[model samples]
Target chain A: MTFRSTLAALALAAGFAAPALALDAGTYKVGFVTDNTGPLAFAGTSFTRGAELAAEQISGGGYMAVGAKIELVQKEGAGDAARSIQSYNQLIADRNVIATACCILSPIAGAIKPIALNNKVPLVIYGATAPGLPSLPFVYSVTGLPGPAEVAMSKHIAEVAKPKTVAYFVLSDNEAFQGRFKASQAAMEAAGAKTLGVVSVLSADTDFTAAATQAIALKPDLMMVYTTQSPAAGIIAAVRARGWAGLMSANDAISPLAVFKKIGPPLAGVPFPVNFSADASETPKAKGFIEAYTAKFGAAPDLYSAQGYTAIWLIAQGLKSLPGKPSREALATALNKITELEHDVYGGLPMTNGQAGTRYTLFLNWTPDGKIAAWKP
Target chain B: MDLFLAQLLNGCALGALYGLFGIGFGLVFATMGILNAAQGAYASWAAIIAMYAIELAGLPFPLAALAGIAAGGAVAVLVDQLGFEPLRRFGPGNHQAAMLGALITSIAFWIMLDSAAGLMTGQQSLAFPPGSYPATVFQIGPLLLPAMQAVSLLALAVVGGGMHWLNTRTRFGAAMRAVGWDPVAAALGGVNSRVIVVATAGLAGGISGLAGILAGISTANISAGLGQGLMLKGFAAVVVGGYDDIRGTAIAGLLLGVLEVFCAQYLSSSWRDAFAYALLLGFLMLRPRGLFGGGGFTRA
Candidate 1:
């Protein structure tokens, strides 16, 4: 035989040969859909990087069986849900994506959830944090919804340091954060914290001066805000610029470091609860994740990255539990039956009704020097 | 009453910025009959470049802003050269078809500019330096305006007034108008029509760049994604002010901004946008030519 023919014959033989372990081994595709290039690009980039690292470690014997190789079928969105639906269908048809990890935005998840469920592919949602979505047969969440933390924060203000009057600046279009506002308001008002007013803002709003003027006119004791990082930075700056400084608070939407960078030295000491923080990564799993993540990405992982890393590991646990040949149907069964997952970036995540939300209890605050630290309050 | 005054001042400042941006959006459409969607992109690129000019180049804030505005004009001319110039010169052999082709090309350029800015900045939100705005507040008793906003209002007056004068009184402006009326006739009249087109593109871009910098300076939450949003509002300003009149377009933008603030203040905040649109729609029904257009609405 010619040398080229001999090489081709050897490659074909190696491809067909199945030795290794009696586990679900050899190239498996996990479809990951994220908003990698848009307004919330930070979330998508961080999540996908962590997932990529998790895939690398799993493929290199970090978690599951060494030979249980996984291929991440990555897809990105630029705030287009139609494109996401199209990509999901394409990936399922061509690549046979066994399971899917989807979305940083709740809107995108709302769009693609029906497709995965109808296809019987186990969908692990990473970012969209609306409540009780895991009630669906094929749906599970690896990231915590903001409900628990929002409720707790509201109660903390009312019971611990109740302010008499409060005003809010909310993202008008985000149904999730708007719901977050209601959850927070119910707790605060139940204890008699009268709401002064609500100033609705769109993601497009650049000037919060008018909104600031209106909010200051109310002269509330506490200024409650629920907006993503960009608008959060804008609102805070506007209010501060207008010389209204009673008290200010916000949800995890404003917790990213980018917010702090945008509005430097303006009340950086405000503490907020988040799912995970690099400073509070004490568990063996979290420590390993930080080390591995930093080594791979050349930077420590943030909350979004932690979400992606833990979520992929959660999917890996399902893959490991499959006793026979791996199929989307079998993986769904394994994940549905999974109540316990070890070494979740959440540190042994306790799944309740196939939903894993609420990471280890950790609150983070920005120091005057702009470093993140554990918040005692 | 004090709260009302505060809202008025705040709205006026914001309205001024919106009006300034609308000048560019309407400038191109009024003169060239081409709705330039990339006007917001010019602004986004200006802000991004200004951020770098401040941080990387170590230039003082005003000089950096000027540099950024200059870059905006340069980019606008380049876009015209690539996207619109070709279509205007050699299109589908009909005026309507060429106009449609140019519109599509402008929209494409708009998306391309947004993507290019996003790529250059790694889709990250970049803010100006900490002391970019003065800490001084322009206050009159209960009414207050930040120094940044005060500066923005002043800029709009100078730039807007200068543009009006140039368009009405200057020879170049007259040539631009002649070109707008009929490019072939203007060329026959010894006006270099293509040069006039390029110059108009630069002016529109510079105006947008100035508006973008002013908007970015206000809250320091600058992002490339902000372009499309601003473009929509700019279009609204153009339509409401009168499509073919720059001064009316500017005033209409101001009115829209003020109306939005008042709606949010007096009406329900969540329903403010709906309220503003409803009011504008009613006004437009009465005055179809817009707030200060050439003719009033009339029934035959």
Candidate 2:
């Protein structure tokens, strides 16, 4: 048999076998679409842990709306846009799933959100904070909007940093990320901080020697890096290689401990914002969540995990509110009515209505030793 | 001035790597008229093999590098025998077809190797731990060179010098030149042109492998596409240096590296790649035959 045919057969077998497992009492079938095996796999894995634990907790009678159980069917999106749409379609059509939770990249989620809406499957985005997502009726974003992170960054810079001049570096490949970062730059400029030029680099670029040298020449008091982990690591190395001693601030795209581990001493005093802290065991809920996640996954949870956990919990809450096996319409209605969701899952991020839509976000900064501490704004 | 000097030094150090790979590319073109696209894949395979030997099997660095070079040479021979020989039998007029075949085979090999490596080890950046080598710095006046960079430069010089000697002084080199100057006449004169061709490929592959190993060591990590970008730069360097001129290829490689560094430092870093291509274009327009264009050979 051909490899393609073999793969197809395997997929069919897995799909058939998925529903054979005994369903828990009152368990409402939910589908999870995620990029579990791609460049963003690390984030996906963490998010999956959150979703899995939430599903387990709901099944174990931790919190139920009325008389419904939750069963999650996980599918790997592999970070491809077309694959995510296919996965979402399959979940909605094949599984007859009422709600879908995803931790796929923004572009993939953005494309799949419309499909979810058309199919009447309530879509909850866990990790991605893409701007246009919250505006969609069927789509509910548990993560904060991209604008809040930028605004919080600007506020922090103005209050604590108070640097005379700041230079901006952003990945040119991602239009959504670049647009949000550009707004932050404009805000920084408006807040009486001199804006040096914005340097655009390719997302896959490794060598930062030239970029770092140019930024050094600018002699900015502060440098803002708006990029993901890989390039951010390279940029930090390049900056340190040139012996630049300015304060460095990064956007939420920067992975706190992961970036710190890769960059080591170069990232000393470099501050970046994150939405959740895995190390935070302050509140009972936070502590319990950490213990349960660690027990299940054998590792600490990050922002992705917290967001994933919150997304599933929110979906479960919606599912609980429904009478008897909840339909997609019921789930969508339930999600729309969700006003203030205070869960220990994400340090009690309040979901409130803003001019655009629901705004749910928090900020955390990284210590030099790579500890993620909550950044109180 | 100090920063400029530092950047210049940095550029030269990086350019040496480009020069090393360009020399291999120029060697094959000068000896055999084939633009071996397989050169880059062979280099990557060699580097990965070396990394595997060192990391997985606990082999010494030197042994691992030797194994890598040997593996590169073997792969080059395999490509010549399987890919080039069949096309060469079709006559020189099918050079375009030959180039396309080589490119496809090389790309196929690269993808297979990359996927296999990625699957074998989970998609994680393979890094050499800190202090794998002594972190000493060599300073001469205002110039500061890291020990790793210095070693890389020194290795390049030795390999480059050895290649120059082999090409100019050796009997094999003379036979290869005779074959290139007139293959029919050289064959009639009983100079084994097939052997010469294979030897040239092997030598080029060995050099490329060494370049890959050095890059891996210096960067402390290796990815699937490590050789792809480097190979493009190497090809550009050869074109800018004059396709068949070995020394010119080396010089062009170093010059290109320095240009990239300067652009990254003085101008916008985002434009570094743009600047590198622009320099190549400007140089090509000024000197169509390349900086030292003398050898009558065409490149793809």
Candidate 3:
């Protein structure tokens, strides 16, 4: 036989043998779609692993229906909406997963939320904080809305820096960020802060020297940077290079430890809210999570990890309330009813409306020693 | 006035770096009559390789930079040999086919390089190692210029001066020029055209690698796609300066940088790129021969 025929024969053999290795009929599948590979892999993988760790513990320790263990089915979206949608469909159609969780990107989550509602499956959003998300019933957000954070951030700037004038440097590459930018501008103006100007930069922009110079010349009390990681570093570096000593604050986009290491000393004193802090072992549950996460993963959990871990627990809470095999509607209702609870990682969350969590946004500042610490508002 | 002056000097410094980057694009085009799109990929790779050398291999900053430059040159030579050389030898005899083939092949190679880089760096835009460059600003009268700005300009001057000396004073430059003039004729004249082509590519890649490092220092972060925009700006400089004229290319790059900052300063920052490209379009329309009027594709 020719090479093509030989390869086809081998593939046919594997296809024939596939059903013999199929999963058990009683296996309950839970799906997760996020950036598991590519630039966003660090966050995506952390989220997936967080959910996986919880599922493993629950299934192994018999927290679910007797004789039925949960299998975590993860799809790598890589921050693309189409890919995320594809993964969501695969989870429903191929794996018959009861629930889907952990979409970090606003666009991807926004796209898949409607699908989850239509399919009668519950979606737990971890990272995306878009204001429009909570209105959908089947979708439960484990994160704060960007509107609250923007309001909080503006008020914090007004309270601390007390700048009469503030300039905004926002990344306008997506609708989600644009919403946050508009909300911030409105909040800053409402707080009696005069706008020097609003400057927009592409997330992929490599040079922010010009933008930095322009903003510096304005000499605002604070320069609000709502930019993604790489551009945030560049803008911050350029601003500091030009000797602009004014306070710089951002949304959660700037909270990553990678940003701290990249911008180095310039990052010190810059405050942003984080969903989780490794140093935050204030609650016993948080302490348990830190210890367990370190033991399991060989490193401390990040914000994504905490969000991911909490997302799975939220689903498990819904699952545990059911006396029998939980239907999609029942599970979503249970998730919707989750209010005023403590999680293994994220402590004291309140679920309401279609949204499932209170704003647990903790402000953190980069220290001079290249570490991040909790900052009081 | 001080603000304007500061921005002006900043523009000049930025322009110098742009010109430094533009040289790689210009040099390859001047020699090969093809725009090597993989030039940006080489530049990105150089930054990444340099970062790895420092962050992972524990090499000192300066040595890491040299390693980066060497890597750029080596990768460029490899691309030429593996991708372009065979096309030059056996691609369609038509010029259009040859040009299109090279362009498509270079773009494909760039995609492959990007994928490979993504895999290696986990798509992370890494910061330069701490203390990579001292953040000191020098004030002359009212102008506040970062020390990195001066270094950028001085480096560009050295690069331009070295290139000028190489072209005007060296035997290799003479053979290289001959090949650019007429490769077949140069081959008949006992000069190995292949060596000249590969050498020019290596030299261009080395310069681009330097640009990448400087960009990392200036921006304080480096990503795989960082070079794409810079590559476009550099190509615009090459086109605006009269393609084969190195001095003209440098001058045009400086002009573009200054113009971009002025636009961003006076007008909206969003209009900056629009105004720069408008200038490019104006040049292509009004002064098709470019500012210095050196032969580009036609002569080649």
lDDT of 1: 0.78
In candidate 2, clashing pairs total 3
Name model 1 segments beyond 4 Å from true. Answer: A1-22, A375-377, B275-286, B295-300
Poorest 10 consecutive residues by lDDT, candidate 2 chain B: B125-134
For model 3, the DockQ equals 0.44
Q: Give the number of the best model, judged by TM-score.
A: 1
How does candidate 1 fare on TM-score? 0.92
Question: Arrange candidates by lDDT, highest first: which order?
Answer: 1, 3, 2
Candidate 1 chain B lDDT trough over 10 residues, lowest sum: B291-300
List candidate 2 segments past 4 Å from native: A1-105, A117-121, A150-162, A176-199, A252-257, A327-329, A341-344, A352-377, B1-3, B24-95, B134-156, B172-206, B213-221, B262-271, B278-300
The residue-by-residue lDDT of candidate 1 on B1-300, one tens digit each, is 998888887777777777888888878876677877788999999888888898889988889899889988999999999988888877787767777787888889888999999897778777887776566886777678788778877877887788889988999989988887789999999999999999999999988998888877885756786566567667777668776567877777777777878887887556766765775676567666776665522211
Docking class of 1: medium
The candidate 1 chain A region of ten consecutive residues with least summed lDDT is A16-25
Highest DockQ model number: 1
Q: What are the per-residue Cα lDDT tens digits for candidate 3 across B196-265? A: 9999989999998888878878877677676787788898888898787788788888999999888777
lDDT of 1 by residue, A1-377 (tens): 99999999998886666432235557778998867888778567888898998888888983555567778998776557887787777777754678888877777787788888888888888877876666455788887777678777777766766688989888888888888998888888998999988988886667788888888888897888887767777888788888876677776655666667677777465557776777776878888988988888788888888888877888888888665367788788878888877757665577888678554555566776778786533
Ranking by TM-score: 1, 3, 2
List candidate 3 stretches off by more than 4 Å.
A1-25, A37-42, A82-92, A114-121, A178-192, A322-334, A337-344, B285-288, B293-300
Better lDDT candidate (2, 3): 3
